[model samples]
Target: MLTRDEALTLVKRHVSEENNLKHMIAVGAVMKELAARLGEDPVKWEVVGILHDIDFERCTGLTDHTLIARELLKGVVDDEVVGAIMAHNWENTGVALDTRMKKALVASDAVSGLIVAAALVMPSKKLAEVKPESLIKKYKSKEFARGASRERMVISAEFGVPLEEFLTAALEGMKKVADELGL
Candidate 1:
C-alpha cells in the first residue's frame, strides 16, 4: 500500500488549485478517521481519499470525474483502491458500491464540504468552534452548502454509521487537520 507521504505527493503533482487541495486533504482526513472507526486500514483508506480527486481538474463532468485517476493509478494501486475511488462517483461511473470503503468514500466526499462550509460561516472561521449540533442545523438547511448533497451525506446510514455519528466523526476528522485546511 502507498504511504501518506507518497499519496500526498501524487495529489500535489496532479491537483494545483489551493481549495481543491484542501478539499482532498479534508476528505483524506475524514476517510482515515472513518477507516479507524470501521476497523479498516487507515493508511490505505487515507491514500484512497487523497487520490480520489486527483483527476478533478483534468476530468470534467460526472462521467470523467474519476476516469483519469483510474487510468493514472492503474498499476500503482490495488484494484480495491481504484474501485473505491470510482465508486465514489458511482452515479456516472456505473461502478457498484460493493465495499464499505466505497460507501465511506461517497459519504465522506461531500460532507467534508458541508462541514468546511459551516466553519467558513462561523464568526471565528475556526473548525474548533464548529460543533456537531451546528453541523446538524446546517445540514437541515438546503440553502447552506448547496454543493454538499444532503442525500449523499445521509448515505452514511448504508455504512451502518448513524448520520449524526458520521457527521461527528467527519467533523472531528477535519478538525485534526484544521491548520492544513486553513479553517
Candidate 2:
C-alpha cells in the first residue's frame, strides 16, 4: 500500500513536464477521494492515478501512450495499479469491461479533466473558483472540453452521485492542494 507521496516521487524521477505532473497529482487526489467513499483502498487507487501517466511525457508518439506507461511501471508498482492505469487508456488498452477497478479508474480519469477545465475557465482561473453547476453544464455540452470523455465520466452514476455531485467532490479533492498544483 504505497502512499500517494511515494508514487508522486517515483513518477517525478522519470517525468519532467510540470503541467502533466500536476494533472497526475490532481487525478490522484480525486481517485483517493472516490476510493474512500467507495470503500476501496485509497492508497492503491491514488498510486494508480499518480503513475497512470508516468510515461505520457516519455512516449514518442500519440499512438502508444499507455504502452510506454505500462512498460515503465512494469516492475515498480503492483499489478492491480498497472491494470487500472491501462484501463483508463481506452484507446490504447481497449475498454475494461465488467470490472469495478477498471470502471473506477476510468471515472476518476475522465472527471478530473472536466473539473480542471472548469477551473481554467473560471474568472480567477483557479480550482477554488470552479463551481459544481458549471461542471454539470460542461459535462453535458458534449462539444465543450473536447478531450474529456463524457461516457467515461458516467462511472459517477454507479455510486448514486449525479455528475454535478461527483464533479464537486472531485474538484474539492484536488483543490485541497490547488496552490501546490498552481491551478
Candidate 3:
C-alpha cells in the first residue's frame, strides 16, 4: 500500500531519465483516477500502476521489459501487484493478466499515454486544458499517437464499461491531480 509519492521516489532512484519518470507519473495519475471511480483501493492500485514500468530503464529490449519489471519488484510488492505488472505486456512476457488490477493497469497504462499526448497538443500543454471532445477527436483519427495501443485502452470496456466512457472517467481522474503531472 505504498503512496504514489513513495513509489515515485523509489522509481526515481531506480530509473532517472526524465521521460521515464514522467511516464510513471502519468500512469500513477490515471491509475489513481481509475481506482477512485471503480471504488477500489486507490493507493494500492495507483502504486501498482505507477511502478509497472520500474524495470524498463534497465531493460535492453521491449520483449524483456515485462520480465525485468517483474524481477525487480518481486520482493518489494504484493504478489498480485507484481503479477499485474508482469502481465501488462503479455505479448512480450506470455503472462496472462486476469485480475481486475491487471486489466485496469493495461487500460491506464495505454490511455495515460494518449491523454498526455493530447495534453501536449493543447495550447496550454496541460491536462486541465484538454477536453474530452479533443481526445475523442484524436482517438477517432487512426494516425493520432500512433504508439498508443487503442486495443489496450479498450480493455476497460471488457470489464463492462464503454471505451469512451472509460476515457472520460480516466481523464477526469488525471485532471483531478493535473498539477502534479504538470499537465
Best candidate, TM-score-wise?
1
Q: What is the alpha-carbon lDDT for the whole of candidate 1?
A: 0.92
Candidate 2 lands at a TM-score of 0.88
TM-scores for the candidates: 0.97, 0.88, 0.93
Q: Model 3, 102: alpha-carbon shift in Å?
A: 0.9
Query: Which 10 consecutive positions of candidate 2 have the poorest summed lDDT?
Result: 92-101
TM accuracy, model 1:
0.97
lDDT of 2 by residue, 1-183 (tens): 567778888889878989889888888888778778778888887788788888887777657777888887888777777777777777766746446667767777788788778888888889878777777788888888989888778777875556666777787788887987888
TM-score attained by model 3: 0.93
- Better-scoring candidate (TM-score), 1 or 2: 1
**Model 3, range 1-183, lDDT digits (tens) per residue?**
566788888888778888787777778777777778778888998898779889888888778886877777777788888888888888888889787788889988888889888999888898888788888888878799988889898899776668888888778877876777777
The count of residue-pair clashes in candidate 1 stands at 0
Q: Write the per-residue lDDT of candidate 1 for residues 91-154, one digit (tens) a residue.
A: 8999998789999999899899899999989999999999999899999998999999888888
Pairs of colliding residues, candidate 1: none
Cα distance off (Å), candidate 2, residue 123: 1.7
